[model samples]
Target chain A: MAKSVVEIKNLSKIFQRDSFSVAALESIDLDVKEGEFLCLMGPSGSGKTTLLNIIAGIDRPTGGELHVLGEDIATLSEDALATWRNVHVGFVFQTFNLIPVLTAYENVELPLLLTKLSAAERKEHVLMALKLVGLADRIDHYPRQLSGGQEQRVAIARAIVTDPTLVVADEPTGDLDAYSADEVLDILSRLNRDFKKTILMVTHDPRAAHHATVVRHLEKGQLLPVEN
Target chain B: MWRLVLKNLLRNKRRSFLTGTSVAVSLFLLSSLAMVYTALGKPLENADSIPIMMVRRATGIVFPMPASYGARIREVPGVAACASLSWFGGYWKDPANMFANLAVDPENVFKVQFASTIPPDQLEAFQRERTAAVAGRRLAEKFGWKVGDKITLLGSLWGFNPELTLRGIFSGGPDDQLWFHWEYLNEAIGRMNVVGLYWIRLEKPEMASRVGEAIDAMFRNTPNETKTESLSAFMLNFIAMLGNVRGIILLIGSAVTFAILLIVANTMAMSVRERISEAAIMRSLGFRPAHILRLFVGESLLLTLAGALLGIGGAKLLYDSLRLTQIGQFAFADLRLRPETLALCFGIALSVALLAATWPAYRAARTNIAVALRHTG
Candidate 1:
């Protein structure tokens, strides 16, 4: 009975390369409800990340109505979209794209810098986020000083620090070993279950999909039926 | 934001330091050239207040004029005082200790060249004692000469070597010369009754051109024709002998400025290009394009401003240290780095920062976030 946090109807995305046009996504109909951990599983170049980007307001769709949180994202300007993303959505990339120059604490505080939060409030939020990921002790450590799994945890902390409505991750465990992969997946699962954070993740590993509440497959830019 | 800028600069310490050093050296050279140019014009800055004129042979300064011309020059309607000034090129001990030693008419030199402040008793002693010489304060300090010290000058221009007593030390107005009695040099040179030039002081600054014309006309078409000009024009002719110093400084300054611009532009371009992915990440975190641009520009400003401070400060320190040295005392006696010059250098630094960072920052800001992220991956 949860309200739908994302709604997409007949969405299409086409990329133009010189004189040729390639359809990245065609007539994609998808709905993600609040508190749902939706896993998108597909092969390479199957429009998984393309759809995720569009839903996150990072890229624009070629046609059809696309709405997230009941707002038509396509109608928003670039700056407005960026502001909306800052307030409403969080992102975790596969490569752990934390600014190398910033420390773990500062990296997590990046999004809060855009908000009107005071220094004390930002400190509280950053420390709490780092604590959630069990990285409070490494708060002052630079990104290069941390291990691969730890760096990914820091990225996750940065994503959730702002307490966004939705967290979208693109192959967050693609570069991790088995143990670190499970650790990242466990954290994502905990965020979805305990914090009731809505997560939309793209993955290729079947094991990652096992942690999802609802799983869907895509083939050649078209969505398949949801797996029970 | 500033914290981020600092960290980014520290991220590549070697490159940042090298770029900053280049800026520092370029600005140092540029400011030094400007200081020298300004120093060359220092005498002319107060020339109008003094209202003095120099009358020399029409041919050249090396050609002597009649010392009797001083009496004729003094008779001019607006002339307040006239003195014969003969260059006595001599060295104190070694050729390396060479300075401007002049044989000036003791009775009227102070009246015409009143900028030099000499005590009354010393001025009287200088006029009474035929072999008395007065050294400038800086010249005395350089050679450690005191009052009553007998100094011997080994003349380079004339065959006679003159021994004289230092009667007084004057404090102001090109205080780098030693002045002895012109009558002494006249007698030593077999009573030639010839002088190198005449220094004429006008009763008022407005009478400079009229008095100069009258003086020149008085000696025109005679065996010794005279050319009279204001002190500033005379200094300009003297500087002209140095062979286009202003043009050379401008050329070198322009080349240095352009080179630093290219160096800084290259550095900024490389720095931004290396961080395209990081810029995209920041944009994804809700940093606007303008914010990104400000960040890069702030870094460049910080870098260039630091360099400007170093260069300007270094120039001041270096020149201030040279103020008492032989070269500084003789040539750049009043050399100073003016606040206007410092402000101008700062403006140049700011302009260099903005120009260098704009294109690279713009490219990075306008880069597609998705494409940048993918490309980095």
Candidate 2:
């Protein structure tokens, strides 16, 4: 009986384009317990990413209650939601979106900058995060100077540096080669298992989904239970 | 976060340099304009140090008042110094070599005006010689004359050859004119006396209006009545004759500042536009829209500050090397480009940069994350 980190009740999302209304999500009801590694698998336009965004508080559900860490997503201001997300949830994207200007340590050190941590404390935490991603040796390298796999590891370092309760990854390894993809999945698996971090990952690759403890399918705009 | 801002600048070298240049050029124009404005108006601001002219009440530029009033005006109260000066108009030794020449009282010349950098020995020598002249530094350099050399003026006003020895040459303050002895000239044509104008100096600045009134009132009912004015008023009267140069100068400053604002704004806008995808990525990394806004604004402010530093530095260098004698009467010697002025230019550049960044920042902040992801994908 673990505490639920995310709870969604009758959630739906609608997007308007020029002159047409498109439904991105419809009646998505779900509960995700703390420390559970859940995967949402679907094809393009299947609303998998949309559901992750809603649960992560990056997007609104248009109609219904989405409670992340006990706070309703709709009621939070944009600034409040951003601050909440920084402290409570971490995100990893398909593109290893490291700031090209900053070094590995600095990029990993960014989210901590928003906090009131002392410079020495920030450095210590940043070093530990990079070490966790096995990139402590390349702390001073710029994102452009790092390999694709190394850059993705730095992105991972940045994500976990804040020690957030929930981690949301959308197509996290979609841009990497097999070796890099495997390394990234292994790190994410370790984050969920060893660190006991709750992970909600959206992926189209079956092999990538296999690392998750539980897998859920999304078709068009509805969530379906995984078949045995 | 600031580290990221710094890295972004270095990563895109061409864009950063372009933005920096836009800010630098605007600052350069502003600095130069301020220097010129300060140079031109300096004498007017220090009017207490300079003297005024006494003109005939009804006489205009073409007419002349009797020379007898020069001696009579010397007797007025608060008039610590007085001298009569005939325009002597411009001297042309050759038709091509023309410059200012004035017939002035040798005895009272040193007594009046900001004496500038002339020694007492030279002034005494010039006065005792009777046929001597004290040439301005600029006029002496133009004719290549030494202290004892004789200069012959082919006078346009009196239409005579007034040969006089250059007893010494003295540098005058910003508003100096060349002078030769009036006694020497008037003696050459005795009883044919006529003083072009009388120059009077008051001992205290506050006494100027009172003395000016007394001088005019003393001869108010006289046959050769007079009109007297402060030197600043005379200079302003001359400046007024130019009809809208001051207004035009102000208009030009405004226009230049406006053009600079546009240049800065355009640079910031382009910088923001190119970083849309990057901004989207930042948001996905849990950076709020306000964070994105500050990054863009901070970058612009930094660019403008760099430009302002360069522009102000260049201006100070230019002002230092400049020989103002060749650039008309720049009434102040120290036409400096101040640090505060640089800060102000930086401030203006920064404001323009920030203003220019505002719209793009809004666009970046309110960006539809889903659409941005879709577009990038």
Candidate 3:
């Protein structure tokens, strides 16, 4: 209905580790509309992670074009790609990798440091993001003081604090218990539905995939349209 | 940002304190040793306190001058007085108390030089009495000498057993020395034909060179050649005998500074490695790689400054309360830390910290967020 926020054409990635070659992706063409909740489902090592990384501009594709948020990331240099990722893509990792040295508020305020925002403004944004994730009270707590689910919430808060266009989550709930996983999924769903943020998630869990408006399956690096 | 750096330092208080202490100790040794070396080598602050002995017109080792030259030297231009001296090497009645003891004309020795520790009345009284000598306070204290005591010295240069009365104990002035009269010394040697050197004092110090030349020309055909130097230059020559101790100390100082640098660098590398995941997380949250690098490097500078302050404080305390006065008349001139040295140490430490940060900061800056997250996860 709206213009696509992420446009990809003939995207492919090859993994070459110590002279062993593996085709991680093959001519993958996809369009993600603005505010869409898209799920990429596949078994482990099926190019789901690679595709997500490429979209996030964290990795460059071996061959093909990827235009995420109107920027052809494949043509950008490493520095430009890093800058682009900072402004356009936010990542949620499976392990909820928060900096152990920093408090939850500092962790969430990290992204704002790159901006020219005043310290007061950065604090306001960080508090709002934490409140959105329902962890405003835990702002001063260290990562070790938080639960697995709470840490993931802080990670998500860090991701959305900058209000980027695309949120790329790579099995964000994989390390949590079922209840915690559901709780994290609920927050992610609310982000998509209420904030109207575009999300591209990689997950093998069917129930986790259920929140996406569109779910695509990848097998052997090839994307297959869902029959349902 | 400064708050963050400070907080991190305070957070790891034990580790920070230990590392800071190591740096402080090394720098303390460096600064204190430098002060000691300077005190030993530099000219005494007061110049008028000691008598000067100058020989004329021969550069190498001082061969024996004819005993007749001593009388002629007494008549040279600007010469207030003169006395012949023989370098008598003294061994204490106990071997461990051995120190420098030279044989001089005892009558003129007191007139030409002042021994601060010796009571004036007693020094005059010792000069009038034969075989009587004033012992330096430090030397006397070392061997436990009393005014009326008798000490035995084994003399190597003149080859004799010299028994002397310790008439009074004397302390140090600008030129710290220990001496006894040549009369008591030469008479005991059973020879009246040899006087090894001449000690001269001038009313006007600047006329010493002309006076030396006039004296040397007076004995042109004599077999014993002479070498003359000002008091300051003679002491400088003595300093040369220690064989580049100053240079060696400086080299050690630089080496210690570099060692501290390496330690700081290693710490930074380990810290950066441990924080790889945090770096990635920050990058993902739209924080630039440069920001992380700054944070890490800033933390290093903070640690180094703390160590430097501790080191400088310790050095100041030690230098101010130096107890080296026990080493005889040699007083350290202005034994306080120079602002320049403190500034130099600070500059060196800061540079070392910055140098140490380069690798870690570059690694953090170049790390790929995607790859970093994957590995960390």
Model 2 chain A: ten consecutive residues of lowest lDDT:
A94-103
Window of ten residues with lowest summed lDDT in model 2 chain B:
B325-334
lDDT of 3 by residue, B237-297 (tens): 5566567877887888878887888778877787677677767766666556677778788
Instruction: Give the deviation of candidate 3 from the true structure as CA RMSD.
Output: 4.8
Report the C-alpha lDDT of model 2 over B5-61, residue by residue, as the tens digit.
Answer: 776666678877876776677678887776655544543556665555444444453
Against the reference, the lDDT scores of all candidates come to 0.89, 0.77, 0.77
TM-score of every candidate relative to the true structure: 0.91, 0.89, 0.79
Model 2's chain B yields a TM-score of 0.80
Question: Of the candidates shown, which would achieve the greatest TM-score relative to the real structure?
Answer: 1
Order the numbered candidates by lDDT, best leading.
1, 2, 3
Which residue pairs clash within candidate 3? B58-B226, B104-B182, B117-B170, B117-B171, B118-B170
| Model 1 chain A worst lDDT window (10 residues) | A219-228
Mark the regions of model 1 whose C-alpha exceeds 4 Å error after superposition. Answer: A1-3, A225-228, B41-45, B56-64, B119-121, B148-150, B158-160, B186-194, B206-230, B324-331
**Can you tell me the DockQ of model 2?**
0.56
Candidate 1 lDDT over residue span A1-228, tens digit each: 999999999999999999999999999999999999999999999999999999998889999999899999999988898899898899999999989989999999999999999999999999999999989999999999999999999999999999999999999999999999999999999999999999999999999999999998998999998756
Worst 10 residues of 1 chain B by lDDT: B324-333
Relative to the unseen true structure, what is the C-alpha lDDT of residue B170 in candidate 2, on a scale of 0 to 100?
83
- Residue lDDT tens for model 1, B236-344: 7777778888888888878888887898899999999889989988888888888899989998999988898898789988877765234464335556777777787
CAPRI tier for the interface of model 3 = acceptable
